[model samples]
Target: MAYKDQKLSEEKVFKDPVHRYVHVRDRVIWDLIAAPEFQRLRRIKQLGTTNLTFHGAEHSRFNHSLGVYEIVRRIISNFENRPHWNNEERLLCLCAALLHDLGHGPFSHSFEKVFKLDHEYFTQQIIIGDTKINNILEKVSPGFSQKVADVIAKTYKDKLVVSLISSQIDADRMDYLQRDAYYTGVSYGHFDMERILRVMRPMEDQVVIKSTGMHAVEDYIMSRYQMYWQVYFHPVTRSAEVILSKILHRAKELYESDDFIFKLKPTHFISFFEGKVKLEEYLKLDESIVHYYFQLWQEEQDDILRDLCERFMNRRLFKYVEFNPNLQMKQWMELYQLFQDAGIHPEYYLVVDSSSDLPYDFYRPGEEEERLPIHLVMPDNSLKELSRHSDIVEAISGKKRTDHKLYFPKDRLDAVEDEQLKHRIIEILYGQGEVKDVR
Candidate 1:
């Protein structure tokens, strides 16, 4: 059969919790979804360690990927027949949206930090590499796979299409905000996504919002702000991420040590342990594989590895105290020594985790990742950068809010044999000594 034969006779739809239904047309997209690489997303949690805090945030990357594709599908439908919009790019946009999160491994944030792997790099690799996804896209059209990969990498010549997949307010964020809100059962992610889509207009270079939909747009900006703090940056979630990162760090240390021997071989992570991982090895990992390894590490001879593995596998995560590394250097050092003196590996036990977000921007020409600021197209065909006209977004525009929390195994700290040392540690963390950094 010819490459052009990859078009479906009927549309296929998926029932999604965030969007009622995610519709797919064309055999290329259908085949891409069935590819093993894309299906692997089903086992990787979207929020990573957030489920430890929210309990219901067990949604997978596959779930968010489909929702993003569905949003783009609707956006394209709205742009159809409109000037400056090219129907030819529709399939490319859909494929990129569906495969954007393809490279996320188990516990993505911690995994990426410990291994220094970029999920985005792996994402492009999967699209253009010798994988089933690449094969399907190539069959659709020669160079088609590269086009999808480029759109994801933000290097595609078509800025308009790239903006749809990634921008200050694009389909990816829109879908995840609402979908994450729904799964976590939090009211913060609620926003008028349908209204925002209705008001979106395809322009010469980027997608812009209609002036009339400014309120809906403001609500979106605000929704993102709340979700970041309430759900994404919640200290409890960061605690789990801290422990998870430490586990990876501890394992890597043991892997490099001549004295350390593993009771359970880290076969899947051998490449990572060597400081680099091939695409094939990276793709083999999912949340289930990580869980299996953690369970096995619980039986390891290393006290630190065994304890951390048990804590993570059993959800007995570290407890956190808010602290500023800049201002509280003395206190941080004191506690670091206290843990060490108490017979705990302070490196794994004491952790400082920070998360930050810029709610909105007013289009700085060459700075700040150059996120195309949201533009409100007025009735006179005039374009005003979002923060100028919307008071709600203007208040927080271009401002970066950051949260920091110090994580440690509280149960172990409480078991310290020295009563005076324990009292001193508690006084600095909880009493009048709290750091004044307002997130």
Candidate 2:
């Protein structure tokens, strides 16, 4: 099978901080990026609320898409003329990487949680549906678009192609870990990509790391763990997310209430509230539209909506204190009531945020969905699951880490002139005599 007879007259290059330069040689990849659907990534932030915590993380999905594509290009270049890597899958891998996050919208996580929108479904729609992406892909072959989507969906029959971009430790992870660290100015994501790429071997159905590169693999795993805790799971980011969720919830409630009146009704959010959003409308909603509503809602009559929007916009984030959920249920409820008495809407102002994630999981038969586990190719051509040989991987695998915190507005409570009510709320938050000493 031959690829589409497409090539750029001059290779386009995007100067990226993580991958250095993203090269575009194929017309299909170029056209897909230029398509309005793909360009929408420019308006959608890569880390969503994380930008509130890490000021440098204002990068977009457009940045990550290019990074993923560059990583795949390097991987393919490394595997060229090597055994078990089909040259035919080259274009397939590149297309899959470029379009992987094409379905993401503004504030992807919060929007997905509130509106029940699946970025993956929209990704498939943009790729195989009636769109510029599909048109360009079909220029290569009638079935090429589906082939690319299958690779992204991890349903492609060729495991080699699917593994290149979708496996546990693939181009997507490799790019994001480094790219996110670079943008967020975090030291946790520094890993030896060149060494990893040099040691990468194409197996019968997947890519494997040579045994000598075990330390490099260990570094990558540790980097992922650190990046998760230090950047992705930061409490400040979660605080912003909490505020964003409440803002959306308040807006939806107002829209449903007969008493509520809007200076300008949000038509973009109407279908989302009704749960019938179309693709065109979804594409129109980037971070700009969401920010526009937030700015407008700053003057909303509903105090909860206005307050939450102002807090989110001004970076007056919720203050969090460490707490044990299992043991502190009574104290949590008492604090909620105290907040209500203090004239703060407990539903919108007081929150409990809990985040739990497994950094890495080894292959557990019948346990998990069986993540395509990373394997180390031994001298005798035998493969070993990483945890079985590396103590670091074993120590971290299957271990779920959790963080719990109680979030509330400290600035508001500080301004309270009611000494009795202020003392009560502070006592509940910090235990009896703790508040008096701190003040």
Each prediction's TM-score versus the true structure: 0.94, 0.93
Q: What is the lDDT of residue 113 in candidate 2?
A: 81
**Residue-wise lDDT of candidate 2 within 185-236, one digit each (tens)?**
9889889999999999999888999999999989998888888888888878
Residue-level lDDT of model 1, residues 313-337, one tens digit each, is 7888877777777778877778788
**Once model 2 is optimally superposed onto the true structure by TM-score, how far is the C-alpha of residue 335 displaced, in angstroms?**
2.6
Identify the runs in model 2 with alpha carbons over 4 angstroms from their true place: 1-3, 357-369, 398-400, 416-418, 432-439
lDDT, model 2, position 178: 91
Clashes by residue pair, model 2: none
lDDT of 2 at 177: 87
TM-score of 2: 0.93
